[model samples]
Target chain A: MLAFIIRRLLQSMIVMFFVAMVAFLMFNYVGDPVHQMVGIDTSFKDREVLRESLGLNDPVPLQFVRFITNAAKFEFGISYQHKRSVTGLFKERLPATLELSFVAAFLSLVVGVPMGVYAGIKPDGWLSKIFMTFSLVGVSLPTFLIGILLIYIFAVTLGWLPSYGRGDVVNWGWWSTGITTWSGLKALIMPAITLGLFQLTLIMRLVRSEMLEVLRTDYIKFARARGLSDRAIYFGHALKNTLVPVITITGLQIGSIIAFAIITETVFQWPGMGLLFLQAIHNVDIPIMAAYLMLVAFFFVVINLIVDILYYVVDPRLRLDLGKANGA
Target chain B: MNKPLLSVENLRIEFPTRRGTLVAVDDISFTIDPGEILGVVGESGAGKSLTGQSIIGLLEPPGRIASGSIKLNDRRLDNLPYAQMKKIRGKEIGMIFQDPLTSLNPLYTIGRQLTETIQTHTDMTGKQAKKHAISLLEEVGIPAAAKRIDHYPYQFSGGMRQRVVIALALCVNPKLIIADEPTTALDVSIQAQIITLLKKLCADHGTAVILITHDMGVIAETADRVAVMYAGRLVEIGKVRQVVKEATHPYTKGLMSAIPSLTHRMEELTQIDGTMPRLSDIPKGCSFHPRCPECMDVCKEKQPELIDIGPTQVACWSYHDRQI
Candidate 1:
């Protein structure tokens, strides 16, 4: 198991390196970073100083080396727009995005899995058909649209929650001071639901289809022949076997959820890395963009590694040597 | 003789299709006395597995028992509510499918599966169930019974997994164990071992068995009585030895000749000429007439009713009377 985890982590590092290299090159190749850095009216001396300052004077490989080394050391330079350390801006913004994605993923699974399970068990029943139809709507409807719909329902019509913003105030300092009250939770409700809806469709469809396949497996029939109660058969044996793939898919989709938050956060104006990323992109802030891009790539790699490791935990056969160990 | 362990009569299974209702199991009837091992053999799509699954009420959608009376020791089993039928499934009649790898849950330990079955049907405590499971593992010839009970289904070899399945089937001491091609998945050598083990175990427990397979060799070695099916209907049924030597039905004779023999040498082995008709295209009269080498003019227009030929029951017009 430890070996499996270590191997997965190592594989993750390789993937991260490839993603970083590609993204860095793509960011550089898209346009002249130096030109963007120094405005059109800049002097030769200013352009040279800015180029030297940002280390754009170096070759592509050397620039990548410098970027990687500085990234590793948490020295992402200063954001041109924010006029602050790029790392500091990321550190401040990372938590809110993480918090939002985590809650959204949780809510997706909590709501979607049970609904999927219920649908699988009762495929022909009215409730199951209704849930399945509802899931289709969830899948087809965009996150931004869901956000708008939720805001309209819960914020405009019902008057039950705040429509936008993270909370009453935008706390962008050393520590977050707001977003502590019930109304704050109310304000978060729309964005969270919007974030969760997309993930919900993914998880729901995965669970439902996987569960339907599992229900047809002979083991479930064996469990049924054992005279286990319907609850035990459905949840105990069937659900556990279905979870291996469901978990892997859900885990891999965390990257997608994070990606979705870019739109979700933008829609609700939540103070997260997603909004920060949008601002950074529009203003051509290289330091902030590089830092955010690398961080997102890092997260994608880590979450996948975690999922790969979890495969061993969920099914022990993956951990054991099935006689012939490859490259032993 | 007073009350048979199970008596299934006029059992029929029909699947609804866009065209019409397709008969999967057509008017099959059989009975198992206490401690009797009745083997049901047929080629694929002959409805052997369907009959067994239907008896256990495990037949999935589209295929259902259209009209039948399944009596377990004189109690009607077919009409019972699902909740009550579930109780009777494993407690009264356990089942083992063809694939051992698939028959047991991959995620759960053998011990947990066994104990769960035991606890579900019996009043055994967890500790007692564990002890029983360990004993069952040993009884099934698994090595390291005490330690190996924690192993998952994939950890064991094919034969060992079949044994585990048998052990699970025996956990509740069910009166009838329906083993559907239990040895089919094992290698030829392991097949005998599993067959021997299942027959011995069932005999020891006096649990009646319905061993469904197409292998005549398995039937010859394990089954006391064999029922031969063709195109979803029983064509021949009798004592195994008698059926092997003197098959009254032409289809049964065709099947027997098709089984490769070490001594018999022929330039072209006698093969059943046609494929078993698809469920949708069953012949109007005798379902096997299209494939029967001895098919007669009347065989195409009239379905033969099962008639007693001495001790055996055969449904063939050729056996309607003594040879001219």
Candidate 2:
């Protein structure tokens, strides 16, 4: 198991290196930091000094090595748009994005799994039909449109919520969460739903199909023949089998959730990393963009590694194969 | 007989399709006494498995017992509520399914599976159940029962898995066990070992068995009484020695002749002329008439009812003296 984890860590390092290289390449093409940093009245000699100090005058390979080394230490220079250190900006905004994504993911799972199981157990029931219809709507409608619809309903029509922005936040050291405050939570509701809707439906459909497939397996039939109670058979035997695939899809979907929260963030004007990334893109803030890319890549690698380990944990067949491989 | 352990009377199973209701198990009747092994032999699609499933009340949907009474120790089982049936299952009747490799859940340890079944049907504590499960594994001949019980199903070979399946069925010591083609998925050499283990365990537990298989060889060795089914009906039933040596029904005789013999080497193995008829297209009269070599004029016009013929019960026109 330790060997397996070490091997996966090595693979993650390789992936992160490639992403770092891509982020380094983005720095060269996306406009010079010197122009963005200085005013028109600044002398050319001052600009040259600033460029040299920033290591823009260094060899390309040396600069890339520096970028990689600095990235490893979580240093990403300064955001040109905000005139603040890129890491500091990320540190401030990451909690909001992660908070929103996690809540959305959690809501989807807590609600979606049971709904999926119900639909699967009784595929033709009236409630299942209603869930299927709702899932269809959740899957088909775009995130931005959903966000606007929610805003129009709860914020405009009902006057129940704030239309845009993180309403208020309570700081717990470096981490600031809007959930601790009522107005903040109410403000979080619409954007989180909009961001989580696609994933909710995806999880629902995947879980439902997987549940249906698992229920038909010979083991399930045997479980029934063993005269196991319906509850034990469905939840204990069948649900555990379905979880392997659901975990895989849900892991990938979570990575996408964090990476793709840009539109939803923009729709609600939520003060999160996605909004930061969007503004960075418009202003051509290369440091912030590069940092965002590396962070997202890191998330993907970590999630995939976690999913692989979960497969080993959930399935004994895989564990035996892995043990053999290690022993050999 | 001292109160038959299980009895089925005129059981008719039907599948309602878009075309029409197709009879799968057509008016089959049999009884199994306590501690007796009854072998049910038939060709594929002969409804042998359906009969077993119906007895266990685990028949798949769209196919249900249309008219019948299944009684266990004189308690009516056919129309019992699902909750009542569940209580009887595993506690009163156990089932061993074909394909042992797939029968056990791969995600669970054999110990957990066994203990869960034990706890479900009994009032045993978790620790006691585990101890019982380990003992069961050892009884079925699994090596290092304590250690092996924690191992998942995939760790065991085909023969060993079948042993585990047998152990599971015998865990509760139910009065009757319905083993549906239990050794069909095993290797040829492993098949004999499984059959032996099943026989020994069932005997040890005093668990009567309905051994469903197509192999006459298995029936001859393992069963006390043998039932021969052709299509959806019981064509013949008698003592194993009598059925193997002196089959009276033409279909049963054909089935006996089809089994290759080592004592008298034959130039070629005998085979029945035609396949069992499809459920939707079963013949109006004797379902086996089309394939019987001794097919008579009356055989094609009316179905023959089972009648006592000295040592055996034969369902054939030849056994009956009636003209019509």
Candidate 3:
């Protein structure tokens, strides 16, 4: 198991390296940081001096090595728009984005799994039909539209929530959270739902179909014959079998949730890394853009690694195979 | 005879489809006394397995008992509510499926599976159940029962896994076991070993068994009484010796002859002329008449009911006339 984890860590390093390279490439190609920083009337010689100091004229290979090394320390220079250290800017915003994405992912799993299990156990029941219809709506409607619809309902019509922005944040050292306060939590509700809707539906459908298929397997028939209670058979035996695939999808979906938080963040104007990334794109803030790229890719790699470990834990067949391969 | 452990009277199972209701097990009746091993033999689609499923009240959806009474120790089982039936299952009646490879849950340790079943039907605590599970595994011939108990189903070979399944069925010491083609998925050599183990275990537990299979050899060796079903109907049922050596029903005779013999070498093994009729297209009269070599006009015109002929019960016009 130690060797397996070590191997996975190695693979993650390779993936992060490629993402770093992409971030580095964007620095060279995507607009000039010096041009964005300098005043419109600045002298040419002064601009050259400023560029030189920023190492813009450095050799490509040396600059790439510097980019990789500096990125390792989370140093991405300054955001052009904010003129603040890019890492510091992201550090302030990281907690909000992380909190939002996690809550959304958690909500998706907590709500989706039971719904899926119910729909699966009784595919033709009226309640299943209602769940199927709701899932269809969740899957078909775009995230932005859903966010707006929620805003219009809860914020505008009902006057129940704030339409935009993180309501209020409490800071604890480096981490900031909106959940500890009432208005802040109410503000979080719509965006989190909008961000998590598609994923919840996807998880529900995947789980439902998987549950249906698993229920038909011979083991389930045998389980029934064994006179196991309906509860034990469905949740204990059947649910555990469905989880291997669910874990794979949910892991990837969580990665996408963090990456795709941009849309929800923009819809609610929740100040997070996504809003920072979007503003970076508009002003060609290469450092912030590159940092965001690396961050998202890092999330993907970490999630995939966690998923691989979960597969080993949930499935004994895989564990035995790994043991055989390691001769342990 | 002492009170029968299980009795099925006029049991008819049907599957409602888009076309019409197709009869799967048509008016089959049989009884198993305590400690008796009753072999139910038939070709594919012959409804042998369905009969076993009906007895356990685990028939797949859309297929249900159309008309019947299944009694266990004279308690009506056919119409019991699911919760009530569940109490009887695994406690009063255990079941073994066809493919042992898939019968045990792949995700669970054999010990967990065994102990879970043990606890479900009994008052044993976790530790007691685990101890009982290990002993049951050892009884089924799994080596190093204590250590192997924690191993998952995939760790065991096909034969060994089937033994685990047998152990599971026998864990609670249910009075009756319905083994549906239990040896069908096993290797040729492994089949005999499993059959012997099953017979011996059932004997040891005094568990009446409904051994459903198509192998006549298995029936001859393991069963006390043999039931021959052809296309959803019991064609003949009698003592194993009488059924194997002196089958009176034409269909049973054909089935007996189809088994290859080592004592008398022949150029070819005899086979019945036609396949069992599809449920939807069963002929008006006797279902097996189309395939019987001694097919008579009367056989094609009217279905023959089970008629006693000395020690054996045969379903044929020949026996019907003799009885009259």
Candidate 4:
């Protein structure tokens, strides 16, 4: 068991390395860093000095090695646009994006799974037809459009929430009154809902399909034959069998959430890593952009790793029977 | 003799389809006296499993009992509500399915499943239920029952899992146990063990069984009375010895000749000429007439009603002249 896990972990590290390398190369090679670092109005001597200091004089391989080694110590160089430490810039913006994604995902699972199970169990019922119709609409509409609609309804028309920015953080610490604090939560609602809508549809569709398949498995029939209640056949037998794929889809969804939050943050004028990512791109802030890209890739790799481990834990066939040739 | 344990009269199941309604199980009727093992033998798509499932009120969707009456110890069972059916399921009539590996829930320990059934039907506390579960597991010949009760279903082998299922069926002291192809999913050697275990356990407790299978060898070895089903109807019903030794109906005769045995060695085992007709494609007269070797013109024109002949009931025009 230990050997198997160790081998899997080593493979994971190799995959993560390739992911980090690609993300690093994309931002680094996309544009000239020296011109941006020295600015548009720098003298030849100043440009030369900036180039030397920023390691533009070094080879690309050496530069990547330096970047990677510095990243290992979390000492990404200062952002030219903000004049802030790369770590500090990311630290300030990371929490809002994380919080938004977490809440959106939580809401999606809480709503989507039950809806999917209900619809799958009664595919021909009126409730199922309604849910499927809603899901189709939800899937077809873009998040940006949904975000704008939410802004129009809640902000412009109703005047129920603020249009942008992080609200009073001092009055709304971790242990504030509740989720209904005037500042932080009230500000988070619109963007979270907009982001959660599409994810909810994806989750619901995948869950419905997976649960339908599991419900048709031999084991479920066996459960029914054993005189188990309908509730037991559903939640007890079908639900657990469906969770493996659900976990994978959910993990992949987390990656997309961070990727798509860029638009959502732009729409709501929310201060998050998405906003920072846009700023880094506009000003050609290489260190910050590289750092941000690496961070996103890191999240993708880490989430996938956690999902893989969970798959092993949830299914014994994956754990005990890995040595056999993969087949049905 | 005491009252019959179970009685079914004119039981029929139908499915609504685009091509009109399909009769899955036609008007089939039979009765099991107390402590009788009635072996139901038929090929796949013969509606054998459906018969077992219908008795327990677990038929899947799209199928409905079109008309029938099921009586358990003279009590009407066909129209009882779900709650009452549940009350009878594990308490009065225990069920053992085909595959033991999938029959038990993987998430729960065997002990928990057994104890849950006990606690659901009987007036036993958690501790007492646990004790009884372990003892029941031991009675089913599971080794280290005291410790193994806490182990999940996946931990046990195929044979052991079937034993656990048997133990669960026996836990309630049910009057009739439905062992639906109980040993069909195990290895040949393990199959004997399970068959022996089932016969011995049911005998000890005076519990009747309805053993449904496609294997005639098992019926010959285990059953007291055997019912032969074809297309969805009972083709013949008689004592196991009489039916296996001397079958009356042509379908039963074909089934008997088809079983490859030491004494029956021919160029090809005398297989029934054609496939078993699908429930949707059953012919007008006798469902088996198209496939029977001794089919007559009258057999294709009129359906044969089951008639008593000596100690056997044969549903064929050839034997219809015999009086009850």
Best by DockQ: 3
lDDT of 1: 0.85
Q: Count the backbone clashes (under 3 Å) in each candidate.
A: 0, 0, 0, 0
TM-score between model 2 and native: 0.98
Candidate 4: tens digits of C-alpha lDDT, residues B1-324: 577889999999888999999998989999998788999998898888888888888778799899989999888888989877877887788888898888777766788778877877788999999999988998899999999998878889999999998998889798898888999889999999999999999999999999999989999999999999988998899999999999998888888988888865678787878898876678989888777778899988899888899989989998877857
Question: Residue B208 in candidate 1 has what lDDT?
Answer: 96
Interface RMSD for all numbered candidates: 0.9, 0.8, 0.7, 2.7
lDDT of 2 at A239: 89
Estimated TM-score per prediction? 0.91, 0.98, 0.99, 0.93
Best by TM-score: 3
The DockQ scores of all candidates, in the order shown, are 0.69, 0.79, 0.87, 0.38
lDDT (Cα, tens digit) per residue for candidate 2, span B234-308: 989889999999999888888889888889989998888878899989997888888888989999999999888
* TM-score order of candidates, top first: 3, 2, 4, 1
Once fitted onto the true fold, the runs of candidate 3 whose alpha carbons sit more than 4 angstroms away are none
Clashing pairs in 2: none
Candidate 2's C-alpha runs over 4 A off are: B322-324
Off by over 4 Å in 1: A17-66, A168-180, A321-328, B263-268, B289-301, B318-324
| Docking quality category of candidate 1 according to DockQ thresholds | medium
Q: Which stretches of candidate 4 lie over 4 Å from their true place?
A: A1-9, A23-28, A59-62, A171-180, A322-328, B263-268
Worst 10-residue lDDT window for candidate 3 chain B reads: B315-324
Give fnat for candidates 1, 2 and onward, in order: 0.77, 0.70, 0.80, 0.23
1 or 2: which has the higher TM-score? 2
* lDDT against true structure, model 2: 0.92
Cα error of candidate 1 at position A183, Å: 1.4
What's the true lDDT of residue B250 in model 3?
86
Instruction: Answer with 2 or 4, whichever has the higher lDDT.
Output: 2
